[model samples]
Target: MTYRPATAAVPDLGVLTLGVEEEYLLLDPDTGENLAVADQVLTTLRGPAREQSRQEFRHSMVEMVTPVCADLTELRDNLVALRRSAAEAAAAAGARLVAIGATPIAEPHRSVPDKPRYHAMSRRYGPVAHDPAVCGCHVHVGLPDRELAVQVCNHLRVWLPVVQALTTNSPLHDGRDTGHASWRSMQLERWPSIGPTPHFESAADYDRTVDELIAAGIMLDAAMVYWYARPSAAYPTVEVRVGDVCPEVDDAVLVAALSRALVATLADDVRVGVLAPAIRDCLVSAAHWRAAHDGLDGELIDLRRGGTRPAWVLVNELFATVTPALARHGDLEYVRTQLDRLRDEGTGATRQRRILERTGDVHAVLDDLAARSRAG
Candidate 1:
């Protein structure tokens, strides 16, 4: 899904500054059925007040955004408040909201809203827009410049799959276990523009390639190039849109912290003339497939050392690499603590399966997710 960031001006903060956007699936509190109540949710949030929340491609999906924040505590507070507000609104509207990768069992929502752009998208994309619900988390981290953003995107290739492995929460599709950690990752690949991007020599080269894609009709606009990592056209930050919408609020915070630290470390490496690792587009695809399939419970392609390794090993290696950057932002301890919690609870995909095992009902998955989402 494309993100149209708000046009309000935000003061330039340091590289450690961050913002996160999370999409949630609105559901019936009792039946676990997807409910099209985003309009009501937004209206409630806007009770004589302006809010950053907005609609998504599906009426059942709504995105809550946080402002530019400096640390994890501020980020946590903003996120918790947003989730609470949305949940209260959903309850008032006779619905509920949950943060998961995809709806295990949901009716297809084919009716498009009366918006002109959505109408055009439905016409251009056909039945693809009518598919069942999917939600994701996008983390935006401030960057020094567009050139550095391009370099960071290039540097981020091999690590993309590793990160995906960490956040694989969507395990069910169409009411059945898909046998994959993040089914949404695979589902998203059906789109031509939603994958790892090729290396660009510079910011100008990246812009030209975008122009060419639009010229060739492969993309509708800059907003349509939904690469896993890209320079946000609407902001000065680099937006990383690879992970599924995390099941827990702290999971979302962990992903945001790691993303910000990764960009800061990579950009500093570029500034110091350290050589950036080279990665091929095909290898990147292969790596992503591995992560989307196995998550941390299985092996992963070690993009840096060029071999296969357990996802746990790969994650520890990454933690070591980004430790200094995390220290720079005073995020090291929080990152580590949150990661431990994630591992102990199992990624969202594992939890979804566990819920199914316990309750012997598919609806239990959505029920549990909604409870956890609101509890935060």
Candidate 2:
């Protein structure tokens, strides 16, 4: 069961085409419980136009696959259309499709999708794969060859935590405010292959390590190498698989644009042999921890500065780092406007906490997230 890209050859790798893939949980609108009805939602979405909405490993979750978009505007438009289709289907199934990274309600133990790989995961990993309803956003940036792509991932290791900081949408897990911005990432960390990957010297080194893992039965296949960023198994692009799934479509646009710009900047650096200084995994992990624990409102470990700074300051530095790349796509103003709005209004993570504070009801957070998602 090998999956390949829908279109193999990309035009002009210099332009950096991109595709955005997002996973989401379906919820009962009233109680905010994860409804095991993704199949029903996907069934309602059936037809030539609705192929982008598909099943995930969990029965309560669905994935949205966007077309290979050229730029941010097209990405936003396609995401809006896809979300509209998914919302209608979910509504028809007596559920609301949420773009949240993790469900707030205490998740009822539910069945995994009836797939051989999923069944095997449940059998082997038990609760981690079957416990909570979690979702993520994956952004694929065009990189023609595996070597450049692997290099891009290696160079990206240092800043991935900062990017993840801006999109921490899963603060509450299993009905408790977990005191962290993205508990979905914590659940993800349960997997052995999950989290940041070490630097690989070359594409062969990357593939060879994966081969060893598969041969040793540590991973089922090449697709199971769950690095924060890696060469896509099915696409001629490097996929960044971190970040909690965002509620608003525009937030998704912001993440995608920033991520693409970051990757592009790194790819350029790789070509010039001017890679950023590599921070060891310990510091990288600590920076990520601070990012998740405090999100934007609190301080974060500034790896470049070797000290802690407010996340907003760190995030601003991130934009500065990739300013040239964002400008290349004429997305500087758009990114600036969107990121400013995200900072002012706060991400879904901060907003989720505010909602809980205001209503004193965890369910209100879900309702707000669902309404915001469905509205877009």
Model 1: per-residue Cα lDDT at residue 276: 54
List the RMSD of every prediction in angstroms: 5.4, 5.2
Worst 10 residues of 2 by lDDT: 1-10
Query: For residues 211-258, what per-residue lDDT tens digits would candidate 1 score against the true structure?
Result: 999898777788998999999988889999999999888988999999
Residue 4 accuracy (lDDT) in model 2: 24
**For candidate 2, lDDT tens digit of each residue in 64-84?**
899888988888888888888
Q: What is the lDDT of candidate 2?
A: 0.83
Candidate-wise lDDT, in order: 0.83, 0.83
Candidate 1 — worst ten consecutive residues by lDDT sum?
Answer: 1-10
Superposed by TM-score, candidate 2 places the C-alpha of residue 91 at a distance from the truth, in angstroms, of 0.8
User: lDDT of model 2 at residue 237?
Assistant: 93
